[model samples]
Target: MNPSRRGLILGAGAASLAGPTLAQTDGLVLNGRFVQGGFAMGRAAPRAIVFVNGEALTTASAAGLFVVGFDRDAPPYVDIEVHAGNSVGGRVARRTLTVAPGSFPSTRINGLPQSTVEPSDPALLARIQQEIALKTEGFASRADADDFRSGFAWPLDAYRVTSRWGSQRVLNGTPARPHYGIDLAAPAGSPIRAPADGIVTFARPGMHFEGGLTLIDHGQGLITAYLHQSRIEVLPTQRVARGTIIGRVGATGRATGPHLCWRMKWRDRNCDPSLLIGQNAPENS
Candidate 1:
């Protein structure tokens, strides 16, 4: 049986997406925020397929739940097409996604470990490079199921945010990749829960910079990572339910204090974790 049509109204005026006013479609519904570095959950008729910005997307759930996201340097707009499920020939619904612009703050830090801010030694550089390769291979998405449709939650029950996504990292006045994750300050032994249902892909005790880390694949190229963990309770390839304890927060590797760096990546693009499940979400979801 087709599920009842239920979703958030994301029209120009009804939405708080902070983007260009977009026209609404009759049957398409979206929740979450719509902006650069942001992600949203969408709903369509059952068995419906979707395409966003010319890229084919698999629905996040069997009930036609899907996701749309914008990159850090995404354009102002994107095109979306939803092929609705109907008894007869299905209808096509097309809509434009207006991605709002965002600004990143730059910070300059002087005091840091020599190996951290810059790894001048050949051995250390080699180790860092190997770690990067390991991460890239481990995080390669495997979206065989719609595990993420269950929704998201905070890793730490009681925590404070220390840093935000898209912050410029000026290490010793030299530019580096912008910080792409939200840093949550928690005690070293603070338990961390899985924000959503996913399969653990990478769970290891140490990395060059991340220290102990874990990656959970949530289908359709959507993966969430937990960094600076003091302990990883789950093993690779293990399925975990939402709210399951996956690890514990810690100050490891290149970190300054005890914290968990929560990050989300959709395909090859990094997205803001806060937008997907933070204050910016519609209805604070």
Candidate 2:
């Protein structure tokens, strides 16, 4: 792939950081936030092959659109390469991107039960492990559609942000894993809508940590999860349109109060769903 043929397309929002060096190439273009925990949308020739840092992505669509995600702890640089046409004699395009590191703050949360912080019951731990395995299968979904092309909207019509993503969480005086979801504080029974078109991959109630959880696959391994719901209206394998009500918020699970833990994953990378709100990938030029 030639380095001179790569391009990036950025929209008009905070998600569109100004760092990508767009080239004069015409066939392949990518657009999105060039920061850690952000995602990018791209378009290439139909059936084109895309590789990020030498790993093959889940193949391009018939329309040539694709999406790439930067992990929360992603390195400062990324390399994107596209191969159009057949491998024997195809046009190659490449771009070395600069990814900005995220600035995460420490979040202290107290007044939690001791068992939740440090579980000692063997049976409870085993159940937690089983739940983790089920969630893993949900995150591994990679439907071959660019459903994200419709862009994203806020899941809740009215809510207050209680916790932002990528915060170092300290629960009850003990440091824990970094929080990866944006906590939306809303009244119990407040409806949560689908941010984009997707297929429901997992929906279950009464998990240990997450009392109620619903995961939606927004195509190409980009999945969004809703946690601590009071009522789940959808089921696994169901197709939901954007703005459809999937569930209602609640204070179930380990939460301190009524809220919705909104999380997103693009393949193995955890990205900030807030960045994609009101942002759509630029159309092919």
Candidate 3:
């Protein structure tokens, strides 16, 4: 239940969760990895209010289950503040999270559809904006499901990691957003399983950018998305367990070949899917 009290830590990356007791600072317990593009789960006194990154936007569960997320380009240090006890001016157990950097490699590809790489058509631009809004609304709500606490798995049985998180990408020699998801190379129509327990938030087919896309809510602001699928077997609001076949991999949307693009998002920040699996994935992943 209480992750911090139990001293349980998740995420296989370049960061470690501090022990249960701060000792020199206070009696707060925190767990979870600290690498860029990942998340950390922290627990404290039930009555304590937690502030992350100097913002009061983070909400702790009634059991004091608060989660912090780092983006792909997250800063080297993050500030965390905990207001413990009932005292008016409680101790500011503010801690700066030392984030471990993730090495990224640059990739270049030429001879792609210019419109697909960079939408120049007015109608297509409107569609792209609309799709982005729709995708954003997909995971806007937070849930109480504890599936993410368990961990994740590879959607495919075995595959090569052709791309990694935050890798530089140049489409037709024009720079674009760094890749944010891991690419699992598989044949078209290959089964894609759910990596962890979650509820399907949105499943749409043939969008302009992501093609067949599905968003699974794993609770506590933890979510994962399946992009560029040939087929989606799950529907919105459906509950799925780890290893369940949720879709079929394929070359859809703007992709170059058949593969599954798996992405993770914690609250509003992006996270590397590999970190949450509790094991070190291949370097290309």
Q: Cα lDDT for residue 110, model 3?
A: 77
Q: What range of 10 consecutive residues in model 3 has the weakest lDDT sum?
A: 2-11
lDDT of each: 0.73, 0.83, 0.74
> Candidate 3 — number of clashing residue pairs?
0
Candidates 1 and 2, the one with greater TM-score: 2
Give the alpha carbon lDDT tens digit for every residue of 80-143 in model 2. 7778873525787766666777878899999987778898999999999999999999899988
Instruction: Return the top candidate by TM-score.
Output: 2
For residues 115-227, could you state the per-residue lDDT of candidate 3 as single tens digits?
88978889999999999898989979577655765668888887789888878899999999898898889889999999888899999999887889999988766789989
Q: In lDDT terms, which candidate is top?
A: 2
lDDT, residue 160, candidate 1: 93
- Pairs clashing within candidate 2: 9-30, 9-31
Cα deviation at 70, candidate 2, in Å, is: 0.6
TM-score of each: 0.82, 0.91, 0.83
- Cα displacement (Å) at residue 161, model 3: 0.2
Error of 2 at 153 (Å): 0.2
Model 3, global lDDT: 0.74
Residue 102, candidate 2: how far off, in angstroms? 1.1
TM-score, model 3 to reference: 0.83
